[model samples]
Target: MIVIFQYLSIILLIFLPMPHYLRESYLASSMLYSLVCSNSMKSLIQYYYDQ
Candidate 1:
C-alpha cells in the first residue's frame, strides 16, 4: 500500500506541472507501466507455483 501511494504521488507530481495536452499521454504511459508490472508479478507467482 505504501508503495502504491508513493507511485501515485510521484505521478501526481509529474502531471501537476505539465500542460493539458501532455497530461493524457503521461497518464496513459503510467497506466501501461502499472499494467506491465502487475502482469509480470502475476506471472512470477505462477512460475513459482509451477516449480
Candidate 2:
C-alpha cells in the first residue's frame, strides 16, 4: 500500500498538468495517509490495553 502511494505520488508529481487537481489530489493523499496512521495507532493502543 505504501509502495502504491509512492508510485502515485511520483506519477502525479511528474505527469500532472492541472495545478488545481494536483493540489486536490495531494490533499486527498495526505488525508488518506493520516487516516491509515491513526487506524494503526488505534489498533496498537487497543492491543496494549488488552494485554
Candidate 3:
C-alpha cells in the first residue's frame, strides 16, 4: 500500500498540474506522513514481538 502511494504521488506530481485542488494536495501530504508512520509502527511491532 505504501509503495502504491509512493508511485501514485510520483505520477501525480509529474503528470498533474500545480495548484491542484486543496484535497489533492492534502492527499499527497497524508500519503507521505502515512509512509513514515507505517515505518515506525512496523519497527515497534517488531520490537514487541522480539520480547
- Residue pairs with colliding backbones in model 3 are none
Candidate 2 residue lDDT tens string, 1-51:
865776787687668676878678786887788789879989999999999
Candidate 1 stretches greater than 4 Å from native: 1-7, 10-17
**Per-residue lDDT of 1-51 in model 3, one digit per residue for the tens?**
867877797787767766668657767787779888889999999999999
Q: TM-score per candidate, in order? A: 0.70, 0.63, 0.48
For model 2, the run of ten residues with the poorest summed lDDT: 9-18
Query: Which parts of model 2 have CA positions greater than 4 angstroms off?
Result: 1-18
- Quote the positional error of residue 18 for candidate 1 in Å: 2.2
lDDT score, residue 40, model 3?
98
Q: How does model 1 score by TM-score?
A: 0.70
Name every residue pair that clashes in candidate 1: none
Evaluate model 2: give its TM-score: 0.63
lDDT tens readout by residue for model 1, 1-51: 746865886778675787776777767876777788889989999999999
